[model samples]
Target: MATLVATPRSRALGFGLRHAREARGLGVRELARLAQVVAQDVSSWESGLRVPKLEQLGVLFGALRVAPPERARLVELARNAREPNWLERSMPGISPALSTYVEYERTATEMVNWEPLLVPGLLQAPGYAEAIMRAHRLPPRMVEREVAIRLRRREVLTRHDPLVLKLFLGEEALRRSIADPAAMAEQLRLLVRAAQPRTSSIRVVPANVGYHPGQAGHFVIFDFAHLPSVVHIEHLRGSAHLYDGDHVAAFRAAAETLSDLALSEQESLALIQGVITGLE
Candidate 1:
């Protein structure tokens, strides 16, 4: 059996497999017995330590009675499980990209996020997130889904073995009002509270900071304890998760540069509060 590298696609594929098995109430040995595979191999496939043969994946899906849409998605992920990078576009009903992102984010040890346009999702208030999504002209159902996801994502900060966050917010992001002043102010207040925890750090990078690494665009580096680091770049249309060593290193360097360009933590909180005062 060929072992699959712990790339983002493999991780996502593993998550899909585990979810399918759990949904069907099949334990590893039970699923393996039905699929005619070794229970240990099944564990490896579900942990992203190995890639299941396409035939084996099919058998497992048949055993689990996976739905057509989800079965197709898992098969696609298995096919691309060895890929070093995964680029995903938004899809109707639910976005595969978003689901993959959430899967990786949940297990990440630390996240260094640089945003030049808006607050990081984990730091965003429901009202603020809803406003931004509404401004994007998303379908109302999708907007509600995204808002709910955003709110749920914030719990990662307080969950056991919580995700450590390093956020660099752009000055213009604070200036660009969304929804209404009152809502924006509430959002800023939320940021202030989010910055208080030791596990989270919020810093503001002033606009026109002259040539900074963040000028390129926004990205996040998610460092994991046992898996390779993944660099995620998001845009208006889609998002890409990068696992190549060079790419991850570049994002790490960019995170360092952003740290240098950003205001001190205390100063950042002051600026956030100042923005909140202005809005009020």
Candidate 2:
């Protein structure tokens, strides 16, 4: 049988559906029988060669006894297998690309981030985040909303089975003050506290590191267990999600280079501490 090329959304749905079914010890034939579909159809769905209709997805998940949150996520994925979920309709001014990026962040098991100008959103403290948003000239309401979103994003750091985050931050990110001296100091201290090696690692690339792939701009690599990895690049207008294997590999290599150029975790923490002390 010719294999169907799988896009990110279809791949996610297929993997989730297949995982749920296998966890219940059901083979493809068994699941097909239970869901009243042909064996080839079930195989196609599981392989991401075809996306199941919403009603069919309901039948499959029901047979597998998939539970609440996960079942809802699977349904969402099935409904939008060909395109990103339309979050902008619900979230008034939110960029469609950003909405999709948020979904990717939620589902990703691991994330590698390279930030050249400021702290990554997942690590920015509330005060600093607010300050940065305001500096971007966002409307007062939008600034507040964006800051709230940043804080909410940070929740992933503390969630049960939190994401494995590897962050490469430019040294100037530490010295750059987004808010008042006190707020910057607090933000630096928060960075020190959150730099736990098990769940999160923060590394700073010194200013003197003359040239690197990261000099191109900020990007994030989202890694999944079942679906293909993707790289997200953000710009002033919108963002780009790169799924092509070569592009993904190049970004992965860049991440490794940045990691190597960055200071050790302990050294990075000490440098942050020194910056905080200077602020005091």
Candidate 3:
């Protein structure tokens, strides 16, 4: 019942390129001639039916006389276009990482997030996000920029047919206040409130669980309408998007085990409230 969907970025990039061509007073036929690519190829790319390859991207960029940084961005986008996987499709531009995150949020039917170190991005309040970003010493403008992006991302929760977000947090994340006590309390209350059946659900893994697979780090598993479940593992340097049958099975098994070990929905809210009280 699951089918793999191409990353939204591919389509967006293709559309951008097409628009760029038209803005330059060049038709698809003209761009194809300039890029030395087939007219059908340009047509397919513009229609989002297919993405151009790396060499093809270079030719197109050259034809447009795109600047170096812009050309580099386009090349990066082309590299991302490879395999038409989430790694390629979910993000298409310079900020591909964040774009990918946003795209997944849009199309996902279900999302399971486990974060061991910090609060999950989807649920972070602006003040809490700002505090964390500041501690990391990001420039003020960058911190503000990321906070804005994160807040915008929250819109997914209110969409007509929103993605079901199931979050599992390590107890330490809740117990350790990232911001001031007042801010932390508000975030804790927010988490508890957000667990309502209609919108979102959250469960906390007690530290007493001793050891668990998620202890290694943070990851998100997404279920898409057209694809089998895929797990996104994030690291300090890079990320791996897992879709292989075996890897997907293992991640799913881990999620099930974690869900079993974590507190039930009602108990989780109680636990959150307890932490909020303890914070004061």
Q: How many residue pairs clash in each candidate?
A: 0, 0, 4
Question: Per-residue lDDT for 160-223 in model 1, tens only?
Answer: 8889988989998898977689889999898888885579899999986898888899999898
- Model 3 TM-score, all chains together: 0.76
Q: How much does each candidate deviate from the true structure in C-alpha RMSD?
A: 1.8, 6.9, 5.4
lDDT assessment of candidate 1: 0.86
User: Against the unseen true structure, what C-alpha lDDT does each candidate score?
Assistant: 0.86, 0.80, 0.74
Error of 3 at 244 (Å): 2.0
Query: Candidate order by lDDT, highest to lowest?
Result: 1, 2, 3
Q: What is the lDDT of candidate 3?
A: 0.74
Candidate 1 deviant stretches above 4 angstroms: 1-4
Q: Which is the leading candidate under TM-score?
A: 1
Ranking by TM-score: 1, 3, 2
Tens digit per residue, CA lDDT, model 3, 1-280: 2212244445446656775687688988889899887799898776445777777787787787767865676566555654434443323222555555566686678998987756787888888899988997888888988888887887788788888988888888988868999889878887876785765878888889988888877889888775456578766544566666777788777888889889988888898898889877
lDDT of 2 at 77: 67
